[model samples]
Target: MTGTPNTKIAFKNVRRVFGDGPSAFVALDHLNLDIFDGEFVTVVGPSGCGKSTALNIVAGLLGVSAGECRVDGDIVTGPGPDRGVIFQQYALFPWLTVRENVEFGLKLQGKEKSERRKIADHYIALVGLTDFANALPKMLSGGMKQRCAIARAYAVNPKVLLMDEPFGALDALTRVRMQDQLLETWSKERRTVMFITHDVDEAVYLANRVIVMAARPGRLQEIIDVNLPYPRNDELRLSPQFAEIRNKVWHAVYTRSGQQQPALEE
Candidate 1:
């Protein structure tokens, strides 16, 4: 499939399957999607809907069984520095301090020690982790660990961020704060982001558009545009507009195929 010039990530009739023959399971079926440059897109659906599967394809952690997954017009063959991935697990190195963790990718790229330090410091500060730069992962709270993971991803200067339930493990209050912090960072950095979440509120709160997927052999069930202005906060979350959009995403996610209702409108 042809993608527009502005498309940063494109999935053309993508399909992914596991196993073979009679017991084969299809995770994604003929999926087609486009994430534009500098746009924030959140994906939500029930378990086994391929939300993470799609993100994994973009991260080059998994291969598509059919069709293509492209990044910046190039076919995705493997992981590259241009794409950064964050999962629900912090995946931080227990032996490394926050600064070292953030600098890991830069070190792999053969950056000078001073240059890596500067970049890591900037991103660590960006994620509000300046105070813990020297602390190991064990010293951080769940939210703080996630923030460090995010900072580490950013320090690499990726063009796109593929996040799979990055805030899922945090407490309610912490999750809310992380959402705001992430939006603030996105506003300043403006990278293309495709975040996956099971929470409808979180999906609507953080995305330019929310992608809802069907169960099993996942395909796009609906795409809801979030027209609300950004710099989103707790005050915005309490607004009726936010609830409206949240409900739309909720219905799209929970409503089953045969019982699907008419789509909601603004």
Candidate 2:
């Protein structure tokens, strides 16, 4: 997708501080970012690094202390349907069927029952979970549950997708599979994605660009491009170019995350 001169998401000198007066804590300092349409940008850092906080701000779930965030040329203030968020916890309605879980947002927006069903079915198919549409969350696997969460996010036709470690709970094999599924969906949908992940390979594989955040106060440390072609699969992971990008992101995370940080083996 082509982008206009205007940025899809802009974070200009943004800062988020907690509390008031002497007891304040700065979560972000002079943070500036510009995410373009169809760009998959991954935010990575160690625990308590405020990485999730950045996603929260962009989602309009949290207010910024300073600076501003704009999505599609409009200044963000409160939560809107333009931005869809998928969190680590699937957050599905346990009582609802997988299809109903995906349709929840549409129902809230006053969509007709039949229309919601169609939309839900489309998304479930998109995530390759068509067979589980009638199943309940309690009956699905962890990865499948996350897929439902992703389907729910997409059913709304959001302008930007914000994911905060959405697959962190899955086992290693499942995490890798989910990552591939996400890449496939994104390649087809091309939605502006701002994702948070601690997995270096996942970030390198899925992101068009990687943004490394420092721990504690959380500030941008570096921005690196991932020129890996779309539809990255296990084969791409074994290639040299992928290894190079992976190394860069790994080192960026390692140091920024305060690890020495190991390099993504090149």
TM-score per candidate, in order?
0.95, 0.93
Per-residue lDDT of 93 in model 2: 95
Local distance difference test values of all predictions, in order: 0.91, 0.88
lDDT of 2 by residue, 1-266 (tens): 21357579988888999999999888888888899978899988766668888899889999988888889878889899999999999999999999999999999999999999999999999999999999999999999999999999999999999999998899889998999999889887779999999888888888889998887677888999888787778899889998888778777777546766544433
Which portions of model 2 miss their true places by more than 4 Å? 1-6, 256-266
Against the true structure, whose lDDT is highest?
1
**230: Cα error in model 2, Å:** 1.2
Which pairs clash inside model 2? 254-261
Residue-by-residue lDDT tens digits, candidate 1, 1-266 = 25788999999999999999999999999998888999999998878889999999999999999999999999999999999999999999999999999999999999999999999999999989999999999999999999999999998999999999999899888998999999988898889999999888889999999999997788889989999997788799889999999888887787753334544432
* Residue 176 displacement (Å), model 1: 0.6
